[model samples]
Target: MPSIKRKVLVLIALLVVAFIAGIIFSPFLRETTYQLKNWVGKPSPLPPVSKTVILYFSTPKGELLSPVERKIPVKKEINDEIRMVIGELIKGPKTRSLFPTVPPETKIRAVYTKGDTIYVDFSPSIVKNHPGGTSGELITIYSIVNTLLENFPSYSKVQILVGGETINTLAGHIDIRGPFKKNPEMIEQSKILNR
Candidate 1:
């Protein structure tokens, strides 16, 4: 009878230990079990390490803007990312269907952010090399404005600065004296083609 009681007590002690362990490790065990059961399928996809920046380039006719997405290394600073995007714009469109808006010779001088506005300073080549006409100027200005505003929606306005000073117009057409907002109508919504 004493041996029987000892066995019963031992079994109860083991059950108590198992219950405590289950309570302590239920979450971990549940996750491990789930992973094991789902192991037959493909592994979960990894998060994207790079980010896409939408760049606007003029269409062949230079009348409207077309957006092209370019993947770039994510930058810790917002200004650095903005500079990267502008640099891509200067590089021009990868697809032949789109034309460059910013002058190829142009260089980004600096990019600054204040409140909801972004100030982009460019080299004088932007003005000197610009193909100046009302439409040309409009495309150029809106290209910069739309690209910046679209990618970074936090910024509501963009001001273009040439040679480190605020410019009244990109090509003596549109008044660029103040910050410009995104012009959705200027962007071609018919299609989104990326290279």
Candidate 2:
């Protein structure tokens, strides 16, 4: 039988070897052992390792604009702005005066969103003479539709209403009941890029 002192010496040697082996072969063991030592009983005071992730907003041009990007609330999408841009484009090459002629009384009431369809509401003045003839009206309406549908391709149809009332003709032509599809005529040189 070994003496108690000799047994103590043997146990100490084994513990030292285990400690060294753990340090060299597995760093995880040290962490587990430390945690176990602290959590033997009662509540464990140590905090768990965090694994949360956060995302930052960025433009297509790779410009970072997030917590540090704006003093005022920033819009993540430009669907409305893009649609307006198309409207300005429809007003003609010299579209700088488009806004002033919009008629303050004639304003967009609301835009109803549905699956692949958008219903845009405008004031009564929209039905007024919109400069161009049937072609002008076609160009105007289609410009808005095509631009919107392009900016948001997910949508397949668009409907325009005048002062909460659905008009039969934009300028004595073109049907307005059904949601209108994108107008191919408005698309520039390259209409639909397949690739």
Best by TM-score: 1
| TM-score of candidate 1 relative to the true fold | 0.75
Off by over 4 Å in 2: 1-106, 190-195
lDDT of 2 by residue, 1-195 (tens): 569889999999999999998779786877889899888867657653321211111112222111111111222344454335434332332222122223333556666667778878876666674543555455556655655675556789988888787888766777776789975544333222111
User: What is the lDDT, from 0 to 100, of the residue 126 in candidate 1?
Assistant: 96
TM-score per candidate: 0.75, 0.48
Q: After superposing candidate 1, which stretches have Cα over 4 Å from the reference?
A: 1-48
Candidate of highest lDDT: 1
lDDT of 2: 0.53
List the global CA lDDT of all models.
Answer: 0.91, 0.53
Model 2: clashing residue pairs?
Answer: none
Q: How does residue 15 of candidate 2 score in lDDT?
A: 100
